[model samples]
Target: MTISLRSRHRWFSALQQLAQSIPYPLRGLLLGLLLWSTLTSAWINPDPVWQAFAPESAIAALGKLLFNGTLWPHIGASLQRVAVGLLAAIAVGVPVGLLFGLVPMIERSASGALQFIRMISPLSWMPIAVMAFGIGDLPVYFLLAIAAVWPILLSTSSGTAAVNHKLLLLARSLCATRSETIRRIVIPAIVPQILVGVRLAIGTIWIVLVPAEMLGVSSGLGYFILDTRDRIAYNELTAVLLAIGIIGCALDWSLQFLQKYWQPSR
Candidate 1:
């Protein structure tokens, strides 16, 4: 029985290693192929009604969109919005998070209200955002910022609270000013946590971006999707959906790489 268990474990470990060794791009391609195969098999006897959804049509549409530079403007607009929203979140969340971490009284006082606000979905405020900001990119920015800020604030506060007491004590012993200590020790100590917050914020922002863009925005991936649907271009719509997933994945992978790269050397 012991030998059998050992052999099973060994086999599992080998399989895991083999899977890990496969390149990410190759894995993505394999997944795409599997999806393509499934779709092809499912639609073997496709009716006219389902012709727009054919895999070949989608592939052709994707190729045309890529080759003709038709998709670049929408991609750029979405990226710009994401960048602005992320920056706003960092600016607001980091300072407030630091305050919460450093002052227990303030945190206690505001915790309930903060949690209440955080629990509210960003999308729920869409009508208010549109009414207050009056369309264009402003309302979209507001929504994305709202969606992103909570994760950043929470992560930053947690990181700050978990900072080493020994380090703080050392700074005190050295008669370091509060600003000096924070600048030299606290910020550096919490960098990994900040990156974590940024990563979370990015994910939240990306998710919110699509729906937010639907709110009277003239340009963006979301707008493109609506346009395609209105035009009865299902193939183009599918291609855009694929693009969104690919871009989001790339953004996440980039952040993960940055987080790993920025970790303090042990």
Candidate 2:
């Protein structure tokens, strides 16, 4: 018993020390990495990553042409797909989450089905998406939805199920209706978990977007990557790659910021 107690105490002490040692400015460090990737790439001779940095003035001119000039249209197309898919997922996920979370019968019925679908790869659905939706925006959006939805749905369900029993008891003591209990007691308690799911889904969809966009879409960073490859515009390719990374990191940071502000106790 003494040995077990000593081990447990040591483990907790280590965790507390590690957590406390984390730098306050870690977020700033991560942001700086995204912003400075363009400046820190290794020399790959004959590649644009090096050539693109010609003169600062020349680099600025080219980057301006690439991003402000040609990139916006691509960005817009990608955003459209991402927005539609993510919105659809949220719509579908939140309600399903509520059902499974609030209704044990629903949860029991879904156990195997949810596990099966979640286990299936979103990329594996590519053939099906293409066959059903064909080669345009529909396929792209389909891919995004498949890639992103499960995390949100699963997390929301878990959050709903795990809501503080004390809060529920308090609501009952106040004679709260089921709807009122869910709205007032449950929603606030679960929002943080739901936000985490949102963050996870965003990460999933963002990573998938480029490859999905490369599906012969005229505009999107995915297309831009393909176009650069075919044109041997390696510098342009690298720049777009950098842009995607920076944008994804920024999106995640934004989500984190929202999570922190929305739940200070978290």
- For this target, which candidate reaches the highest TM-score against the unseen true structure? 1
Give TM-scores for every candidate, taking all chains together and pairing residue i with residue i: 0.87, 0.76
* After superposition, candidate 1 runs with Cα above 4 Å error: 1-29, 40-45, 49-51
| Cα deviation of 118, candidate 1, in Å | 0.6
Per-candidate clashes come to 0, 1
Query: Can you write out model 2's per-residue Cα lDDT over 1-266, one digit (the tens) per residue?
Result: 99999999999999999867878777576566544554544443455556553334334544775656787787777778888999988988888898899897989998898899889988888889999999889998988998888989989899999988888899999999999998887878889888999999999999899888877688888998899889877666766776787678888999999888896244
lDDT at residue 131 of model 2 (Cα atoms)? 95
lDDT of each: 0.89, 0.82
- Residue pair clashes in candidate 1: none
Whole-model lDDT for model 1 versus the true structure? 0.89
Give the worst 10-residue stretch by lDDT in candidate 2. 53-62
Cα deviation at 77, candidate 2, in Å, is: 1.9
Q: What is the lDDT of residue 247 in candidate 1?
A: 95
